[model samples]
Target: MENTRVLWLYIILLCHYHWFFEEIDGLVNLALKKPAIQSSTFLNLTASLATDGLIGTRSTKNECSHTGVYHRNPNPWWEVDLGGVHTINRVSVLNRAYFAERLRDINITVISQDKTVTTECAFYQGSVAAAAWATVTCHPGTSGRFVRIQIYNEAYRDVLTLCEVVVEGLSPCDAFYFRKHPGQRLNSQLVEEIQSNKPMDCGKACFLTTMCFAYNYNSDTSACQLLKIGDPCDTTVSDPGWDFYSNCLN
Candidate 1:
């Protein structure tokens, strides 16, 4: 009876909102955000736009034939640049409905600008049915500016296809902090102040408030002060022991 009740509660939660789960630092973090890839700015991994419609936006298409298909003699790949480095948490890939079987044994690699590569799945053998979406949670601390889908068609060399690709992660615009300026405070209004252990904790306080766009934190004093301006650094003066952070999104 207890198990049945808990299951019903879970079902209710699932019906309300779409949820993506990821394990971060040994803790399961719920991802309620959407994909971060910019469809219009995406570039073909190799092919020209005329030959291949491998635009990242098409990956969002529900049907099969709308996907981007890549065909070449050797290894064919597609990637989307997120414009900036991000703390990537999850990657969802939708297989083409028509010949989903051609995508077997593909590789998904995420690379940062610093040349750091985090391979989400190597030689992934897709056994899922056609038009199915597969989601993979990246390792903790996984981050990159570019997400690449490399398909080495060694079998029949038919073609590599992708219906859609969604990258879920903490973008730089989502959260960020700047270094402390010695002896300087900004003209940005202070909204609130609270005790915080780390810069991230202070950032969370700012993120929770709609009016807060920036914050100042003192690591030694554990003081966190949320600011009202979008960019605190613009108005800040030299201040020691106080680090400034702001949401680049604003």
Candidate 2:
């Protein structure tokens, strides 16, 4: 009976771990955590309130400020540079145009030195707004050295304005940026000092706090990260924060 109990416990723990990892791709909410992904060369990137002019609005007045470019053909598409090697987990994209058609497909793939694989991360089977936000969950697979996102439907009626694109699972260190300041405000909670004797405190805090979405535990500096979760507006991942802290603080 003890052995059976242990097996059951293991299964439960595994499920719980997967459950905690969510794949939400909509307007962006506290529930979804920002991915830690970087390209091997160019590095993953983003746009901002100042750069785009506003949040939650289709800014036709201005184009994407990041390396992302707007195209006249097949609507519009922006290619993000996911630096380094990684296995993709989840993806989210926004274009916000309906007349462009209901939409069709969302594809996530990777290209390496010798081989290329296309793993269907997420998909929508019809027409969608030119400014529509689409999110896809890719199958959890092995290591992918290079990653790319391709969305398709109607051809170039309008430029596919990509508002946000994100993928989590495995991306190298170059694709992300983690800026840590213990005294700063993340959403609302002020990071006190690095809490010692309780390293997993971040994970524990996530379980207790409703506003809290994700967290990082700095074992060396004894620091904890409490992020202000938002809808893809300012997506931040706390775990990668801990990775940096590991080397920096120690």
Candidate 3:
């Protein structure tokens, strides 16, 4: 029951009202939330997205110098440039790399044009991957600008298969992810036809149809809701979706 509750929590985080959506493998979108005051971001590792579709693969950069990969990828280290957000409290990263995964020898640093700080936090709490939905929070002792999530060493691969990367508790800049719609429509006739008959798995419906950015599921009434999730990053990752998008049909 606890596990189910956590899963639901994760699904809720994936909703549009409070998240920033990014398209990866196209199987399902890589869903996540902006840094909240006290909440964590939802990430998935069971998927990956390229130009073609979704696949279960990691990043590997061959023929390189110190810019290497434990598993090797076209590049190493997936960094989300927090841009210019000054006040940030914590970072929640979901590790779903499965049993054969490990994020060893990692470094969590706070970087800035003027001020910077670094820590050997790779030994903070987790290993390379999170078997379940694990939470990584920051403490008062850990804070800075240019928040760099670097992989200095890895027990496994430098190419990490991350589902979502959320910077919680936004202090200045505006950043978020989530969907509150059924899907993107072109015509009123097409839209009306959909509102008449909804899907059984509304949460998972949108992603499968390739129309939805995010979705909303009412727990109590006929108030069906969904929305479009916006993108915050340029690079895409392929991971599976736990949330569904509903589609109504004639």
Candidate 4:
């Protein structure tokens, strides 16, 4: 009976250990099979190949995503959308077997969901070696939905090639959730007003603005008013052509 109890305990601990490792592995690669886009494609090598979960560094094998040549694409860039805002930890890039020096002077940036705010994650001044992995730890508090890798040198045009790009991060649950109120407008604490025809654009404008907590979009006049306070229904007044979007959940 003692031996049987010991064996059962060992089995339980082994299962728990396996489950813990699996959960950790799931958070290691957030860019796998995500929506990826690039400035231009070279031949048939598309942007999606970089996030296809293949780490093969041979460009001839068609496992890498390549951009057009210097003259064709002066500023080559590659980006991956993480679907939602996430706190990015690090980004890894695998260089192709041939011509790995093309990735020199590349800048990695994290862009907000509205595409208005950009934060530099890391920059590689030197060329990454052929068939090697270059891992970049993002700056503290770097969070965004889009990860962009681009060559910023204007002296010469360089093609951006990525064999495999991996992003590891944490996806927080308390993301911004906008609630819309039709025929209403928040009347107080106006920050800035912009001409925007769509409610999505108005919401995005408010999202990147640090002082904007809510926004009112006028349908008839195409005016978007960003408000500093987030009193959704309490402070809003009835407006015939305006709609209010609040980021406050409670």
Candidate 5:
């Protein structure tokens, strides 16, 4: 009877561990599936305000100098570098509340490594009204790193003004790591620390924290140090018995 009870307890512990691991995995998958434009790399804008403004994160109907971009040119264009290649799901553009008609005949293009693919990710054909946001979704999605928006040939030359640009998709770092980054210490902004028995336990801790991009686990001490910035590609030698997991963009 004692042996049977022991076996039942062991099974219960195993089931609990499995459930915990699966729950964490599900959360990570949900994060990967969500739209991630707050971290996008803004490029080829007339001013830094395009990126520094509320264009990506907090765009709204409010018309202010700190809310959007104003570019001068008949053929003004802008691009967003998603930092890494991603399976793009959709792109949304919010026009300035004051002069949204300036965004007309805009063409959206996705640029990959060797080729450029055109996408039908725009909702409006002509001009979107002021204080309105338009969404363009790519069916089945497309893989690209750079997404460009251009003001094509129109009868009137209009300056480019954008309240916000949002890009949604799956990230290359959704898998989150390329094995344990051996021998390197990811010394960035320290977030937190916790006791972990295995390297994978440390990885799960890092995955749960939004700011934890990397982690260094000491196998000897069972110490897990979470870091704000780290990349697997940037490997460097550290002390012995230290395994690192890096989820930052390459």
Candidate 6:
């Protein structure tokens, strides 16, 4: 009976482990391979390394992003542009294996596309262990186009280093306003015209524009038109080559 109980317990643990991974795999890392920049570079370690999708904690592995020495640089920071605005859920930072204490007193912030708004996602008051992942859950409805991580303190100066920065969130287009109307165009007030290759880009353009309520994308010509007056759900004219997306729903 003892052996049977042990075997059953092992099976339950295995199932739980599988379930945990499955839930994690369902989340989308919005910061993956996005355009990243840092305040300064240490040697050849660039900001892009932090978002390279590698979680290797060793600095020698060339997977970590490092900033200039602390004394020379007062506050070190790394930022990633998520292409467009997103409702951020959480931010995870993987500490370097050698000196994990350097990642302490970090501030993670979210910035708007227009650079007029900023929100603090999380702040770590203490150090994270080497090779360990420090995850911070953002407040509900925390949304932005840029995610920035910085280390700053008057008493202590530390270079910012990150093995990997994972941001999980929902894209702006995933909201209720992102209804697609294919082969249609909103004949409303025109805001501006820009070159775009895909519907998603057009939607992002509309989202960034203050007066833009909708956008029309022409797949054949790669032309994007921002509209000011109405959305795609309103009275739209049939245009086989154009696709309409509304940014006013949400």
Each candidate: what lDDT? 0.55, 0.41, 0.36, 0.80, 0.58, 0.80
CA shift at 104, candidate 4, in angstroms? Answer: 1.0
Clashing pairs in model 6?
A: none
Q: Name the regions of candidate 5 deviating beyond 4 angstroms.
A: 1-48, 51-73, 114-123, 153-155, 174-250
Tens digit per residue, CA lDDT, model 6, 1-250: 9999999997886565443223221357889889899988888889999999877887777889988874477777899999998889999999999867677888999999999999999887888899898899998889999999998754445488889999998443433245567799878878899998676566656766788877788989989999886444557889999987765353
Which pairs of residues collide in model 5?
A: 121-136
Worst 10 residues of 3 by lDDT: 33-42
Badly placed stretches (over 4 Å) of model 3 are 1-76, 97-100, 114-123, 128-131, 141-143, 152-154, 173-250
Model 1: residues >4 Å from true position, as ranges?
1-72, 114-123, 174-250
Q: Worst 10-residue stretch by lDDT in candidate 1?
A: 21-30
Question: lDDT value for candidate 6?
Answer: 0.80
Q: Higher-TM-score candidate among 2 and 3?
A: 2
Give candidate 1's root-mean-square deviation (CA, Å).
Answer: 11.8
lDDT of 3: 0.36
RMSD of 3: 16.2
lDDT of 2 by residue, 1-250 (tens): 9999999997886566444322211111211222222211111334321123233433444422122333234433333334444566665555543333423455556555344554444555554466655666666563454445545645533333344554455322211112233422333334333363443444444444465544455655667665444445543344433432211111
Candidate 4 at 244: error in angstroms? 39
Q: Write candidate 3's Cα lDDT for 92-208 as tens digits.
A: 444444432454444545555454445422224446454333344555554344444544434444454444444454333122322223223221111111231233334334444
Taking every candidate in turn, the Cα RMSD to the unseen true structure, in Å, is: 11.8, 17.7, 16.2, 16.2, 15.1, 16.2
Which parts of model 6 have CA positions greater than 4 angstroms off? 1-26, 153-158, 171-250
Estimate TM-scores for all models. 0.45, 0.41, 0.36, 0.59, 0.44, 0.58
What does candidate 4 score in Cα RMSD to the true structure? 16.2
Ranking of all predicted structures according to lDDT, beginning with the best and ending with the worst:
6, 4, 5, 1, 2, 3
